[model samples]
Target chain A: MNWHLIAAQLLNGLALGSILALVALGLTITFGLLGLVNFAHGVFFMVGAYAGFVTFQYTHSFGLAVLMGALVVLVVGIVVERVVIRLFYRRPPEDQILVTFGLAIVIVEIVRAIFGGKTQLFPMPSWGMGATNLGFLVYPNYRLQVIVIAAITLAAIYLVLYKTRLGLIVRAGIDDSLIVNILGIDVTKTLLAVFVLGAMVAGFSGVIDAPIVAVDPDMGASVLIESFVVVVIGGLGSFSGSILGGIIAGEIISITTIWAPDYAQVMLYLAMALVLILRPQGLFGTEGRL
Target chain B: MMLRAIGDRSTWRVELAVAVFLIAFPWVFPIIGGYANLATRILILGLFGIGMDLIFGYTGMLSFGQAAFYGTGGFVTAYLLSTGMLHNTLGALAAGTIAAACCGMIIGYLCLRQSGVYFAMLTLAFGEVFYFLENSPLAKWTGGENGLPGLPKPVIPLGFTTLHVQSNLALYYFVAILFFVGYWVARRIVRSPMGAVLRAILENPARAAAVGHNVPKYKLAVFTIAAAYAGIAGGLLGIFQGYMPPDAFSIDQSGEIIIMTIIGGAGTLIGPLVGAGLWSYLREALQNLHGVGAFWKLILGLLFIVLVTLFRRGITGGITDSIGLFRVRRRTAAAHVEEAPAVSGEVQP
Candidate 1:
């Protein structure tokens, strides 16, 4: 009944969704291009957060932290692709899941071993702090910044994926991997780049959002599961689909928190279940992809 | 020979060997630095693993929500006992199992419609939902975070005397008997026509359905069966520990079960027992080791990576493969010697 409350919740949803949008872009690419559901993607997010955390400790620069986070995860992704994931490219989806799952465990456990089980604080830069006034609303300055950053990131990624030659092949590759392979595109290299790009954004999301949520080793798990939900709802591989899915999931979770907090997760799951039942391929997913 | 056509060879020799091992386990265990409790834990996991194999290995359905059924059954039995509603332990355990199976049937109805990763994700979501429900909504009966404790041990009455299964030793024997029964039943199921149908589904779902088999229906059936098995294992956990913790429904529990199943080998029924034993031993050893506080998981993770990449079929599969190879080599060698003797005699003539 309270219009203001609804508006506030909507705004809150946007802030929360910005983080998910960033993460989902990478998930969409991996799922869309490689036909993989990388469970370890979340681990990369955590690793990125640590990368940012350490950079901030030394340099006290948020921008530097974000860059370090991205760079660290990119390098890690390359090593993982070569050492572990490349072997699974030809294997079944389950094998890929299990391998990545094992990798996730290793990454998380190593982080935990180093950091212990405590949650670390990542302070928002002073410039990104404080509140913004919009006549009818007052929102945190950091959150508003998150919305803009997420938008910019999406635009950049969009351009990279569509405008660049490699991006075109990536998109075309999504259409038909076999055909793309026959074209002598070095599908392996292309997929490796895609994986690295995906990991970078995931790490960036972790660094950017670390200020909002506690930086913990196991922080990536819930986010990872929710991201999967987003991908499923948006259609598995469509970039725009995940973006839309992320916003919707954020709104559903944020709005439900007002009435019944416990039911929020349940509602998100129910929404996904309904989507799967009604449209298996998702809202933007190609038919038969399911 | 008659049963071999249906993939139902009795394999009494193997069964007898296992029975002997189970009987001799307690004696050999102490010598190997193992304990009674560890054996009991292994047997329970073995039971649960068999059910997991039915779904994951036999039916080719990767479910990540088995802990839901486990928690459901464990809580049901624990709640009944805590409230004094169930006097007979066996009856309570049976009730708990039925409850878990019913849940599986309902969850499977919605989940089975999705295949591959989606199926796994849906199950994971449902499992988390159950955990939240048990934690917040049904906390009154399930004991929330503290969990239900102080459960009464079961008593068996003989014609002239009554036996109380209370101590760890007694519980081990009781559990061992149940484990044997469970294994026997699982073996029967694996040999049944339904098991063949399941394996067929695992091999190729589209082909299995095209050949007039109802793949989804079979999937649901095996899914329910697995839930029942998990339910029993959950109930046994409460009985063995004398308390049922809410952790039975956790993702970690499900993950551990998956790890154990994989390490032991998936398709083989005995794989779980071996896996559980190995995992538990590793855990105990790692936990007790100095300088390693919580990083034992890292070691296990490394082992998991190696196994997944190099030894995907697992310990049991590896053993069986090598054994088969050895037999083939011996047979070929014998045939070669026989040919040499025949050639020499012909040349002399």
Candidate 2:
């Protein structure tokens, strides 16, 4: 194996892992808090990119684009949870899947109808346009920036979850909802806040990554599936599990590309299958949590 | 009387009415700004939805990957027919259906291990794997995104005389017959011992298992059966269009079928057909609306949300439940013993 190429692929894997980590973070929080699989969470990501796309059209500032994208999606997340998804809190899982799946379709189709079938482009900013010199591996400067930004955001989330009273209540709710209810904490409100936070992070990731890839109606789909896979692999209810699973998923995709590009995509599925077979609860997930 | 007629489906009147409507569809559709092709498409899709309903509505397994078997059947049969490897159209279709069923067993074995949400997610994963395979590695034979084309129409040998079905009108009859037979056969399965077991599993699997019925086995069987139905429907799709579109394996197809099944009423044997009819009609109608155009999906999405929110039992279920309510009100003077079925579909849990 060429050490230089391996290093490049490994770096690329970390880059990919960061995005998965961002998306999976939202999924895990929402799933843990609400016991609802937000299928439309991916659409939030797509809308965020589009939100960024539209914002960039007027502002012409990359930072502004990211901010606007995240904010728009955050509002979208809140409204959607309020009107549509709020009803599903008491509905059966099957109905929940249907409503969200339908919402996903609607969102994708609306985006397509508005944007047409063409891929939207977002260029790398002049400040971060060039490659970064890392002795053995020269990486795209914007990707490096993305990594740092993602890490900072992740750290912020980790601190909020671990340090804040809200975070404590969230953890407490997951462990013992009955006690949390007895304690008179507004669990529903906190869950809504958590869900919206998750959506904002997902949207932030989308807007941040928009410059690197095609921005289209269904762009969030594969990312959404992968994030779910990461959550499952990392352990559905565990925060650290999502991070670990995201890295493993990112590495698998990137490493497989070195040997065979086509199989790189398939490798995620293989990993998921293997995980399900070996440990159905996932690596970090509690057995009874799911 | 109308409610009673609909509520009590023991008679063949409903089937007869359906048969009559189908027989007249090709001719009737043209006068109403519709075509035989649309009707044909609805029937084929309805056939597929019926199978999905068996798993989801009746058996309470919300599998999100019916498209795998569907695409498998389409590609297999499309390949054979286009390559001239299979002369008999029915034989090629059978080959495709059988291959899909076989594929179902393997996929089902893995997916059914995890019940509830896990099964649905696992199926989505595996189903997507098949889709990726279609687009990438298996692209050479499957034609990747381009899909297979140039399939010959059916030629039925009627005891030394052959009947060639080519025109849209003739094709409607051909497809209708197949749909009717499929529906009839499905109805039989729903009435069998296995069907009872499946319903038990749907309503209460834990209790059902404790009562000596093998839960996993039934789940696997129904999953495989659903796949077979999806497979046959897919083969028919290729044969119907003469070219199998690449979207057969798409997540959209799976979603569409589920929507149709739900809209028409899950658990109802004919609910999917009703749902397909309504869904297709709506799709065409919304697209044709002057201001809507591309916004039809947005409207439909809103409609789906509204439907799931208000009409939990769907169109057919809603209608029957209303009738059931009316029956209860009017028959209050009499001793009410027999309860009206909750869902329009007999198999619905």
Q: Best candidate per TM-score, number?
A: 2
Residue pairs in clash, model 2: A235-A285, B267-B345, B267-B348, B268-B345
lDDT at B226 for candidate 1?
Answer: 94
Q: Against the true structure, whose lDDT is highest?
A: 1
**Candidate 1 residue-wise lDDT, A1-290, digit = tens:** 87767777888788778788779879889877888888898899999999999999999999999999999999999999989898888777777888888899999998988888789999898889899787788878888888899899999999998899989998998889999999898888998999998999999999989999969999988788788888778887888888999999999989998888878888888898898789878889888775
The residue-by-residue lDDT of candidate 1 on B82-175, one tens digit each, is 6788877787889999999999998898888788877877787778778878887677788888888988887655659777897777788888
Provide per-model DockQ scores. Answer: 0.46, 0.50
TM-score of chain B of each: 0.89, 0.90
Off by over 4 Å in 2: B1-11, B327-349
Model 2: per-residue lDDT, tens digit, A162-185? 899999988887787779889999
TM-score of each predicted structure versus truth: 0.93, 0.94
Candidate 1 overall lDDT versus native: 0.83
lDDT of 1 at A41: 87
